[model samples]
Target chain A: MQDPQSQIVVIIIAITIVLLFIGILFLVMIWSYNNKKLQMAREKQQIQDAFEKQLLQSRLEIQEATLNAVSQEIHDNVGQLLSYAKVQLNIMEQQATWGQEELHAIKDTIGTAFTALRNIARSLNILKHAAATRVQIDMLYLPEQLQINIHDNGKGFNVATALTNKEGLGLQNILNRARLMGGAATIISQPEEGTSIKINVPYA
Target chain B: MHIHLYQYTQFLSLLVAILCYEGLCKYKLSAFLPMLVIVNLIEVTGANYRALGYIPWLSNHAIYNLNLLLETPFRLYLMGQMLRMRSNERLTFRGIAFLCMLVILLNYLFLQGPFVFNTFSLILIQILTIVLSCFILLRLALREDIRPNLWQDPYFWVNAGLLLFALITLVILGLQQYMQDHKVMLGGKSLYKAIMPLPNFILYLGYSYAFILCRIPKARSLLSS
Candidate 1:
């Protein structure tokens, strides 16, 4: 039979080895547990980012679609009307018996054409600015709010008309996106002044 | 076992589990209460037999071996169900349970006979359970759609508690051979039995907490966003 001391040493060594193995296993578990937590957090963040990006893309698409429709309406309807009015004024001017009042009316008609053209140019500017608008994003860590402000140097509109106009589908889209993201959106603008749209979304 | 400290712990755990039966029922974990009651019954039966006389064939050790055989597949089934829910994948619970039953039967018939303590089967179950628990935890962590708050989820608590208990038990099981050979030199058989109940305590206490704390989700809705 083996000595009791020698047997105790063997058992101690065996137990120690098993303990070491378990220690290694425990460490591995802790590492994996922390690793899983980090991975979950990363995945959640990616999902949030993807969702937000999709919202922004859809908003842009709607805005671009609305702008295209507006430009088409202006060219096909308002532009055609102005061109016809100009042509009629020119034809009246060429008549044999044109009076002073008729000449004044002709000049007034020309003035209206100029004004219409200028307004058309301003509308075109609004479209261009909308296309080129820069969106600045700032996340407030304290309040956990994401603020997105779109800035444009273009002819602005009356606040009431922009808010209530069915034609301002772009603004409506922005507001919808803000609401979807659990936030609010507002447009700040004055006639002939630049427009700035601010959207606030809850980061949480 | 007439262990004073453990008896109190067991009593507390059983009381809590019984009281929170409604919460467990909501989670479709109503089976847990009856299972625990059966466990307590088995414990009492084994103790009664041991007190009657040290009949090796009808001892607590034999009963433990029998319990291991019955509990392995049932535990696996519950874990598998939880895994399927969290993974959103169709897991073959029946197939896995069948395999476990086969393995335990084979081990009992060949390696560790019916009358003897079945360390091999217990070790095998521990290893498989640990691996499955790890896989579940990894899947939960790597999931993209919604990351659940682990503290709030009953399954998370249950799995975590089981994992902790299994890990410690695995270590003890691994050293079983050494302990068996030097039983007298180390401090005799009671050392092993004394150590085994601790992990059980942790597991039962954890289950009780889960019963109390968790607002279990609906069927197949495991993850909480």
Candidate 2:
């Protein structure tokens, strides 16, 4: 027969088991709390990374726009003034009596040089316009949209070729700045079709 | 009161379980919630009927063993939650399927037990069960990243609860066997009867809180509040 002492031992054991069960429940709760903390941290990291990328992109786009504006002024206004100056010299030659064939030849040569300068200016203007193509899109669906649109009407190049500019930052700077504005820029073009640049901005 | 303690605790545990289920449903059931309540339901009621009273109840022998009859799927369900949470590339689904089938086979023999003690079958099964439970505790704790650690960071404590119950079960089974082998009476029946529910009550307490934490957001909020 099982003694009373043995029965007491059994009760003690059972009590211990009950206590242990409570302890286990406590442990599982602690684990859940830690899991929540980890999830919160991951969310915070994601937000920070997104903000930094937007800032960097915006800064680059601004630099590109400034360079293009300067290039356009030098190519259009200054180059045109030089062209008119050469035409005035040509009229003076027609009125002068001293045929000075050699001088006339020299004047013609000067005219050719002026013509070359104008052509150079025209190409520079195309390059400047290509760089200036910028667009701002509204992403927030916010009022007033916080949008910026940069547009350029330069010589149309293949969409792929425009993207892979080797000599200059070209569209790259504009793209970088657009990103800073919490946006992205995409160019659509074909051999004959003009490039259409779209920049989508989010609270930029 | 002593005669009714077994029935009372079983009913109490069942009532708690039903209330928990209603609460979980009210909260809009998650994948984990309903299953958890059911786990407690079957374990409590089945343990009540099978372990507490061997005598058939109310001219309903079939109904008396109904919990055991449904136990295969019930036990399988408990294991399924573990395995599903395990995210095991292999053995998870298979493990649940195998255990479910195993329970069917064992229960068939068990219910039929006039069903001999042939070849230490119950002992072997009990041993294997303890080992499996220990493994479960370890798996739940170690795979904390993937599995929802319900007992929070102190997972060892939950495992400890299982271990303690299993050890008690082992000792009881061993005592029954030793007395049978020696052809001796199992001591004073009244003493064992008094203490029998102690281990079970402890297990319930463990389950009560573990489940309550999951089901009742208010309980949790209150803890913090």
Candidate 3:
């Protein structure tokens, strides 16, 4: 007769082995799944960046066209009028009907007005997608967190409006980029003060 | 004649494995290396006792009890570290003392009958190890952060080796159970009674794989970061 005892022991051990195999297979599946998700997120970000570049080019083209139109109006219309006014003042200065001091003061005021117009015309370079408008983006690597700040010396806005509500295209685009990076943007600025946007993204 | 040669030659191989492990302790793989090699030694001792039980001239002898002398605490510590370690290189000698207490308790409870101690101890070791190993694998599976299985990493050879051992154990036990039900051993030749050591042989293969796997660098990397 066979020993019924050892057989019982054999059965118990066999069951344990099968359970172990199942456990190991389950662990491998979860690890592979997480890796797949990380790779997909990286690829999606690349596509978004390419689309943003194309859209930025189109917007800049339209903006330069508007600036160019304004520049032409100031030069062709107001510029000729100012030259005629300057000649009339020269005659006024020679006749001594108005003091030389008064004539020079009016000329100085007109000169300041022309300088303001020229400043607006200079910005057309950026609007026309000139090489000078290229923005330098730097990403700082830190433990567990990523900080990206875009630096540009231009007119800024109230922090409350940018954070609470989407207003201008510039602020809206900054917010969009922050969201893409899995973070929030902090805009620190005043009316005359320049703009600085800070974004922090966490490692996945 | 072939059987005699196999028995004698196998004994030499087992002895060499044990001595080589002792000599190479500087390699530090010996942290749990002795436990594996000693299991075969225990089997040899137990087989001798079982033979004595069948032959009235010999009785429970002193020489074989030497296996028990160093075996209980050594095997327990060896196995305890296998499941419980943070790393292969980090073994606490202090934990070994505690494991001996648990093993002694198991022996006191389980060693009641006339059945061979080796047979029961072998089965017991396999059951406990399988449970502990499965639990470790379960933790690895449930975690979201561990690296994917490094199949190419040599260090993971321990993992792959453990699975291989479990598989072989599964097959051997399943066959033994089948053979028991069929009463295949009833009329077997006395000399050939249980000479087949396929199950234990595979168990030894598993240990050898584990020992050699500790030498693999990639296995450590997979678990570390």
- Write candidate 2's Cα lDDT for B4-59 as tens digits: 45444445545555656654344332333344445445545544454555654412
| Local accuracy of candidate 2 as per-residue lDDT tens digits, A75-175 | 67555555655665676668764457755655666576567656555555335455435433333355634444444554567756656767435566657
Candidate 3 ranges with C-alpha deviation above 4 Å: A1-204, B1-30, B34-115, B150-225
Question: Taking the tens digit of each residue's C-alpha lDDT, what string does model 1 give over A61-141?
Answer: 876897788688668766776677677677776776567887676677667657766666666534644443443444454
lDDT of each prediction vs. the true structure? 0.67, 0.50, 0.51
Question: In model 2, where do residues sit more than 4 Å from their true spots?
Answer: A1-204, B1-69, B81-104, B107-225
| DockQ, model 3, C-alpha based | 0.06
TM-score of each: 0.56, 0.44, 0.40
Q: Model 2 compared with the native: what TM-score?
A: 0.44
Cα displacement (angstroms), candidate 2, residue B62, comes to 8.4
Predicted complex 1: CAPRI docking category? incorrect
Higher-lDDT candidate of 2 and 3: 3
Tens digit of per-residue lDDT, candidate 3, span A2-42: 36644544554456456545645644663465456545655
Model 2 chain A weakest lDDT span, ten residues long: A131-140
Candidate number that wins on lDDT, 1 or 2: 1
Instruction: Order the candidates by TM-score, highest first.
Output: 1, 2, 3
